[model samples]
Target: MRVVIAGGHGQIALRLERLLAARGDQAVGIIRKVEQAADLRDSSAEPVVLDLETAEPAAVAEVLEGADAAVFAAGAGPGSGSARKDTVDRGAAALFAEAAQRAGVRRHVQVSGMGLDRADDPGMDEVFSAYLKAKAAAEDDLRARDLDWTILRPGRLTDEPGTGQVHLADSVDYGTISRDDVAAVLVALLDEPRTVHHTLELVEGHTPIDEALKRI
Candidate 1:
């Protein structure tokens, strides 16, 4: 399979690229900086320099053309304020989905976050609230699209090694998940067409990754 990923330089994306490559699948990563190309090459992923925040949908579609699947894994970093949360999280995500449609790519996987239900809670930090709202808006937009889309909302992410175990379901209590485990699950989701149109929550658990996906 040939998969194109937005935010190719992100932690999860990089790990995913390596996994795909190791499995003999082609991986293309969209990055804004030319400097990141080497890293993608090291993972055996083709790197395309494009800034989703400023690029038109048609331009992005050009990059996505002939791709088997697309993954939206972009995000504004922790240091960024609320404005970027809207631009990158919500706006960029919407743009990527539109591009996928234009390119005739039917399968899409969106990397979202848990706890979006609390986006409107007054107790949350202002920027965090905005971030959640952006992610939630992005999820709504993807659900309304004419595509085979699966949304994975993973709980607090960590850099710990993957245990190859997880809790995957339509809904689950909030918990933490390793980035490695998240990438592994994404690979399984890409190969499982039965998961289309489902929104799943993921976190660390006893069930093995493949078994967890089978239960989905």
Candidate 2:
């Protein structure tokens, strides 16, 4: 399969690229910086320099042309202000989904966060609240699209090595999950057409990745 990923340089995206490449699949990573090209190449993924925040849908569609699937894994980083949360998380995500439609790529996987259910809580930190709202908006947009889309909302992410085990379901309690485990689950989701249109929650658990997916 050929997959184009937004935020190609992100921790999860890089890991996913390596997994895809290792399996002899084509992985295309869309990044804004030319400097990140080498990193993608090291993972055996083709790098395309394109800023989703500024690129028109048609231009992004061009890059996604002939791709088998698209993954939206972009985010504004912890240091970025709330404005960027809207631009990158909400705006960019919407743009990528539209581009996928234009390019005729039916399968899409989105990296979302858990606890979006409380995004509007009044006591939440301003920036964190905005981030949650942005993610919620992005999810809403994808859910309304006609494409075969699966949204994965993982809990707090960690850099610890993946255990290849997880809890996957329509709704899972809030918890922590390793980035490595998240990437592994994404690969399984890509190959599971039965998961289309499902919004799954993920966190560390005893069930193996493949088995967890099967239960879904």
What TM-scores do the predictions have? Answer: 0.99, 0.99
lDDT of 1 by residue, 1-216 (tens): 999999999999999999999999999999999999999999999999999999999999999999999999999988999999999999999999999999999999999999998977868999999999999999999999999999999999999999998999999999999999999999999999989999999999999988888887
Report the Cα lDDT for residue 84, model 2.
Answer: 99
lDDT of each: 0.96, 0.96
Reference-based lDDT, residue 107, model 1: 98
lDDT of 1 at 75: 97
Per-candidate total of colliding backbone pairs: 0, 0
